[model samples]
Target: MDLSETNQTAYRHPWELSRMEILLKELEKLNIRGEVLDIGCGDGYFDKEIIKKFPLITNIWGVDIHAERCVHQGKEHYVNSYNELQKDKKSLILF
Candidate 1:
């Protein structure tokens, strides 16, 4: 995960997810496009933030293995398989 680093942006602390300038900048760049999909979007809270930050995201897809996690979050689907995601071009995003 972005919050934890292991040769892959391992944050020394979880709070660092918000403190990292580079990450924020990268997010800003992507947000400007206002169209991003977060696959395997766990709780989808981050997805909601991405939509909020961008606002241009006309379509947001938040898929996860646990339907409980996607409950009533306005998430399109809470399916459990990667194949189920391929139905959309946004499926390019994978965990």
Candidate 2:
């Protein structure tokens, strides 16, 4: 099924769930630390779950065209563009 047809909530569809699981496993292999940049993040549901599973992650920022749809408040957690994220040059994992 096309992802565009899925529900607004992240990880609701079977494909989404499977993709997230794969991402998590890949992350485990990398043993990543520091921040994360979630491009095209919808409402940050997956970001919340990612943080829970990875204690080493200091922060997770969501960037999406539909920034208003982001549940997270403040620029610290959500931004409309990549340029906004340039303020911080910390190590980041893009997901």
Best-performing candidate as measured by TM-score: 2
Q: For each candidate, what is the lDDT? A: 0.53, 0.70
> Per-prediction TM-score, please?
0.54, 0.72
Off by over 4 Å in 1: 1-24, 31-35, 75-88, 91-94
Per-residue CA lDDT of candidate 1, range 1-95, in tens?
Answer: 54223232232455544644454466666544433456566555566656666655665667666656666675355456556654544522424
Query: What digit string (tens of lDDT, one per residue) describes model 2 on residues 1-95?
Result: 54457666444788778888988888888787787777777766677778889899988777767777664434454545577675665455564
